[model samples]
Target: MDGDLRGWRQCLLSGAVFAVCMAGTTLPTPLYGLYQEKFDFSELTVTVVYAVYAVGVIGVLLLAGNASDAVGRRPVLLWGLGAATASAVCFLFATTLGWLYVGRLLSGLSAGLFTGAATAYVMELAPHGGTSRATFLATAANMGGLGCGPLLAGVLAQYADWPLYLPFAVHLALVACSAAVLLRLPETVRERRPLRTVRPQRPGLPPRVRSVFGPAAAATFVGFALFGVFTSVSPSFLAHSLDVRNHAVSGLIVALAFFASTAGQLAVGRFGLGRSLPLGCAALLGGLALLAGALWWDLLPLVVLSALVGGIGHGLAFRGSLAVVAAASEANQRAAVISALFVVAYAGISVPVIGVGLLAGPMGLEGAGLVFIACMMLLVSTAGVYLLRRPAPAAETAGQP
Candidate 1:
């Protein structure tokens, strides 16, 4: 039985659950500086710590990405929420740097569990003819929740007591409430089987979709890589170089990028998938330039501008990638192709960030950031050229909403 959930009520409830779980993944974003001070670690260590979360996400996606499809969405989701609560507990009691890594890994597990499962759950709960709106709800929940995590933590850390402890405590309360709300919602996955039966589905790409996948994936990789740098290292830059020690302000800057991305995703429907990809690439290049300028001149304003522009570009490219790849893919093969692209994207988030950290020690943070910008600029530019030369096939986007 499909959990009998229908109408807007169920849709919103599912979205709320998505938001809460996603928020937990980023709750520690603004607090990395505090962690660094307490642990007395290098920038490289900070990036490695952050990258560990992506590792957890990738691991879960590889291992149990389809668990909900097999065991039912509600059950898998309950387990995800449990993992998230445990992550918060880890953070609440974190007395050393090792706890942070463990907490991050657990948070990644929660996100990995929720990402595909929650997306499908929200979509399934929607009424007929509501796919576009449902897509918006899920996207917003994801980006909005990510943006909120740092903002909430920054505020509490700056103004309230227990900078390290309060944020996770608050998140714990929310996760508990979200779980309660979730239990009331209907399970959307029918014909469920035992979780043991689920296997790791190998990621695949159809030959026909290859051309479009190449350029689209390139864009996603750059966007995620840029975000990785910002979230992992920008706060330290602001505090050390710009003398902007306010945690709240640092969090706000990081939050702006995500909010801007949400806005960009919304605008993609107007641009059409074919145009959005190339346009997004161009915008991304411009953003990289702005970021480079920020690093070169050490201008805080430039950094802010870069976040806004880059985030918008990221939004456009990300949504465009989703549409183009989905349109190009055979209906049956869509999930695997999308999964492959995400693997590339998450690689962007982890690998290059660690590279930046490695370079940071020898080249310095600004120099390392400049190097990152240059490399990503080349990647995005190449993608832009490819997209321009070969626009999305008409057949692919013809059916796109």
Candidate 2:
């Protein structure tokens, strides 16, 4: 009993650490408007800046996704925290557009490292027979932390003294505390190798995983694309279209999707993985439709609904996607396969967002959003139908090691 309690405690502590690191990644979400005003940049510049973080994340996932498995979780996480600290510092002292780009890139690197390593670390810390709960905690901490980022930054930026500087300052302090907490936690990987042995993880999947990976990756892409739009441009849309310039309101609106995603992740166990994937796709389609309505009608309530619905869809699809992929892969191939999925997911965040920014120049934000939604709706619908016809074989037994 004592051991189990200790295990749970460690797992929760690890979750807290995970939360802190991720929160830094999104701390700049609400403040992008302020940066634009100070820097005199366009919306296209904002998307490019936001997308740079995804570029960094994808680069890390491709190059060093499995680093923790080799050198141990603590070292990789500590390095991630270091990167996060650098990102915060960059933001704190950002006077030039170049600084924001660098900060986002480092922030991406921090997230890329933490995503795989921290998820694995949290699950490993749990006692036996606690995998399901651990998975929930791991994912919940991830989404919850992401949600807090915008909220924290928006609130601080609104009421605090330094709108641009203070949020990153607070995040720096949080990162330092997280580093200290991480140092006290035990390393979970027992057979650690030297850092020199770590090689870049090329994206590859077994033949059997392809069938499951396809629709799952598609859902993941659309889900993340939805998030990319919300985080990157929703604030701008709210400010320009609705004339809702309150930073706290903008941040809370953006945070809603992530919070809803956490809630959606919690429903996966009840829905079952097989059902969750298709259902998630269905929900995503509905969310996209809601977003279209929000864009077309310029309704504030519609935007809020879109965030809630879309966030739930993202959570359900992403968690279900991760579990399905994990269950289908061999133990030796699990990390690589998961990394590949994230690469695709992060690509969704970057590529499509840049596309929206480009179109935002010609078509306007609402027009560009509708076009993006139309395309995503079509893609997600196709994926949904495919899943309904042929669900992943591993879904029923997912989360079992």
Q: What is the TM-score of each candidate against the true structure?
A: 0.96, 0.96
Candidate with the greatest lDDT versus the true structure: 2
What tens-digit string does per-residue lDDT give for candidate 1 at 198-274? 99867788999898888899999999998898888999999988888899999989888888899889888787766
Model 2 C-alpha lDDT per residue in residues 1-401, reported as the tens digit of each score: 99999999999999999999999998999888899999999889999999999999999989888899999999999999999999999989887999999999999999999998999999999999998799889988899999999999999989989899888889889989998999999999999999999899887799989999999999999999999999999999999998989999999998999999999999887787767888899999989999999889889999999999999999899989988999999998987898789889999998899999999989999999999999999999999999888867898777333
Weakest 10 consecutive residues, lDDT, candidate 1?
Answer: 392-401
Residue 77, model 1: Cα distance from true site in angstroms: 1.3
Badly placed stretches (over 4 Å) of model 1 are 1-6, 394-401
Clashing pairs in 1: none
Name the runs in model 2 displaced over 4 angstroms: 396-401
Residue 275, model 2: lDDT of 78
State how far residue 370 of model 2 sits from its true place (Å).
Answer: 0.7
For each candidate in the order shown, give its overall lDDT on alpha carbons: 0.88, 0.92
- List pairs with backbone clashes in candidate 2: none
